[model samples]
Target: MSSSTPADAGSKPAGPLSGILVVSIDQAVAGPLCAMRLADAGARVIKIEAEDGDRARDYDKAMGSTSAAFGWLNRGKESVVLNLKDPGDLALVKAMLARADVFVQNLAPGASDRLGLGAAQLTKEFPRLVVVDIMGYGRETSYASKRAYDMLVQSESGICAVTGTPEVPSKVGISIADIGTGTNAYAAVLEALFERERTGRGQALEVAMFDCMAEWMSLPLLHFDYMGVETARFGLSHASVYPYRPYHCADGDIVVSIQSTAEWVRFCTTVLRSPEFAKDPRFIDNWARVQNRDALDEAIHAVFTPHSCAEMIERLEAGQIAWARVSTLHDLSVHPALRRIPVEMPGGEMAEMPRPAGRIVASGAKVPPLGADTARIRAEFAGAAPAAAKQA
Candidate 1:
């Protein structure tokens, strides 16, 4: 892997992807997140934005100067403003892609093809360049032209059908559709990179938000299709599992899980202190317990309602039962297990955020401001010879 400029030598943090160049024409959560993960792995990512900049930058001013979404997802990348509609700007992007190891874009449907920046064209022009197109749906599907947002995709994919209370369906509180698609896009890029190493060729790839969410809905879909069973919505509880819901203690609520008969027996004897109840015909097996959940809950509440959460937790630990507190946002803020890393906001303010799993990023990586590197990047790539393509 190599970069277009020697400036990559000491500027990027040392990591597995050091010296690899990524050119991204991206905006919003899914696209920006995929580019950010590449940057995190030591790729030199140049984010090309429109004149007004990524819409997410204007979503909110929660970071004092930048939007919280933009601040969190655009760290350690260069920003270049470009109007792809302009021939010169479009040529400049092509020049950058010529030297880039990867090209990622999440433009609206047909927009990339119109600009001649679509995956097929790019892969044909630069055979060694891995191109990724992120979209709302697969281009072959009828919904390809339909607009997709996090909440809309969630509702369309039936994710809301299995969430929230029985009386109402609800989309997830967070942007799960976007987050999952971003992570999947990142994984797909990594896989493409690995394949390039073996095949000596690069390929075009597509990751659709609807496709990701539909795959996540597999279990529910399977149940409905094969068993003639509709998975019911159980707020804060497991839909198919018995004794896997939270119970109110005297002070707070704690969730308990019993996945096996042994655990159920132990829970009855040690946690509930009622060994005979474990033998009751109404709650002998998981299916039976699930059917008699109301009565089971009544029995469990009889013992837990008079005890504090700490008291019940102690019994749970003694019985080796899996349990967790129903923690609120405040509880999470002060959580003991949460690991944080320091990052510089676009305005130069230092902020601490939760660390991503399975990666160790050095502190103080700065999120780029809009068009922060436009002048420098233009001077570097304008009329400059393309870097030699990598060989397999």
Candidate 2:
């Protein structure tokens, strides 16, 4: 939002999704993120929220005005307040959906069907609407109705089993479950849109957080199933690969990954200052090093502890070692590789944020204030004269 990041570079890209209308009854991360990406790709997203607004609006004040999470996922969208329990307000949402090209929601299990808004109902009624439904678990799962948060899903999907130290398993720092489900739902919507173009009909799609996380655990699952290897937690180190952990230096920390025999040889010779280690029987190959990982780590640690982070980085660069400096959020904020987009906050305050992933070029990503478009939406959907509010 700051002048540091330029806005109004040009008209927003005419992305492949142009002319699409996405109407979502959503909250929290999953549904919002799905719709957010649609908006980023040029679809006009109309967000429906409770009269009290999305509880995520108050998740935190990290963004100065609105919740950092809310602002990040709700950009480039219109906000409309609708009390689903009220007949009149519910009618408004139904009216909008009738004209929508896509409909996405993430309510509790069976809740959509109870409200007459489930994908089955919507897709059948509106043959051209691509309906997306996200859930905590797959529809047939026993615990489909059990509430699921990010940490809960991570724990259930085996992410926690491999995430932390051997002393105790820990959940991932980020909400991979919700994000993964959201991303999957977004992709499904795009696929459905394409299929609809050819078949002249839309389809209903489902994405479950548990299912998404389970797919992400494919590597470990394969090892456990076929190889009978239940990989243990290695903390910051690779469970199966030796010498992959971070080494503390005189100033900071750096992690080096010796993925190949040549890299391991070069690391031992140039960085560890011990050419003999490259040929030592105890550490000759990846298997040998992994077998004696403790010894290998101790040897590397002994060499690295005496040098400064900068000195180690310089040597690693010269030696062609694969390495990375451990970075904090402070480092990431202004990192050379980070790209930021200017955003208008809920209250018209300007702030800058990391741009969403992908190569799609677009602009005019605005963070809407809660229910900012409710009156305008009512006027437009009720077939009245359009209000001054900007559509989408």
Candidate 3:
């Protein structure tokens, strides 16, 4: 709501969060992606980095100039370098936040306190500032001091237990715990902004990767608690859902799901051409089918394994069964649902990145070069009061 460069005033920001100024002190996935979502929705995000910049910038250098992760997360942000330990540099950031509607940070626990940028302190000092803290674990717990990474959170939250085959536990391939925490932070910021509009005040919010992942594991937790049913880790198969996994084809596998008895009936009678299998006592209902999945799958393999991909797909279409072909990265590169836009690399060359999820369609400007806007920003705010009216 402050006029200190939420976006350049003449031309407008595109989405609901337009003109929302965000000052982010962050590095790595959870923190950067949280701010990235805000930037995607038209917030003017100032990404503060150390003198070396975000380490992710050099993470394999796969995006022609910058790391693909850095290119994706830091797009459309104004990069500014600062050392919070230095009084002058710290003052500069304070001025930036003075004008910012939101402040996000993912410093190791207690690091914010060491820098005097703690959420409790910031929100108290500037009541209209929405402060979001991303952590590995809840601050109130003993694990608060423990270092957290995506894999660690996944393991701790029991996600690893349910993710892979029970004999060999494995973490998710993607940084899901980090993404979950980041998305939660993003949603929390929106909720806080809505409340700020009503109350004319802002609040501090926290989302830990561990806590967020635990919440995501709630259904399995409930099952484990009430029925003592620890989920089995069947590759590509849901622990509870029957016939909701890949069936062997000649070349590979085609995933299928049957959520209802009628769908199961269709799958058995139409797809497998075995009408009696649907009425078999051992595979009558979802639970029974789940219990007898190994036998049913063996029978299914006999029917499906002989078919080519084309024949399997044709049968699937005719059967009206819900199914999908697993797409590799090659397939995904040109998929119909994938949307991408050109982003200017550190150099003038352009690289494409995926658009933001959901319907808030926007293509942001070039990702800023490391500290590219630093001198201009410093010159503007040099003699500024703590209130940040210098920008105005």
Model 1 agreement with the true structure over 303-353: per-residue lDDT tens digits: 999999999999999999999988889999899998988888888888887
Ranking by lDDT: 1, 3, 2
Between the candidate structures 2 and 3, which one is better when assessed by lDDT? 3
TM-score of each: 0.96, 0.91, 0.95
Query: Backbone clash tally for model 3?
Result: 0
- Name the better of 1 and 3 by TM-score: 1
The TM-score leader among the candidates is 1
Candidate 3: regions farther than 4 A off: 6-13, 387-392
Model 3, residue 351: distance off in Å is 1.7
lDDT of each: 0.89, 0.82, 0.85
What's the lDDT for candidate 1? 0.89
Deviation from native of the Cα of residue 48 in model 2, angstroms: 0.3
- Tens-digit lDDT track of model 2 for 290-342: 77988888888888889899899989998898888778999898799999888
RMSD of 2: 5.6
lDDT for position 21 in model 1: 86
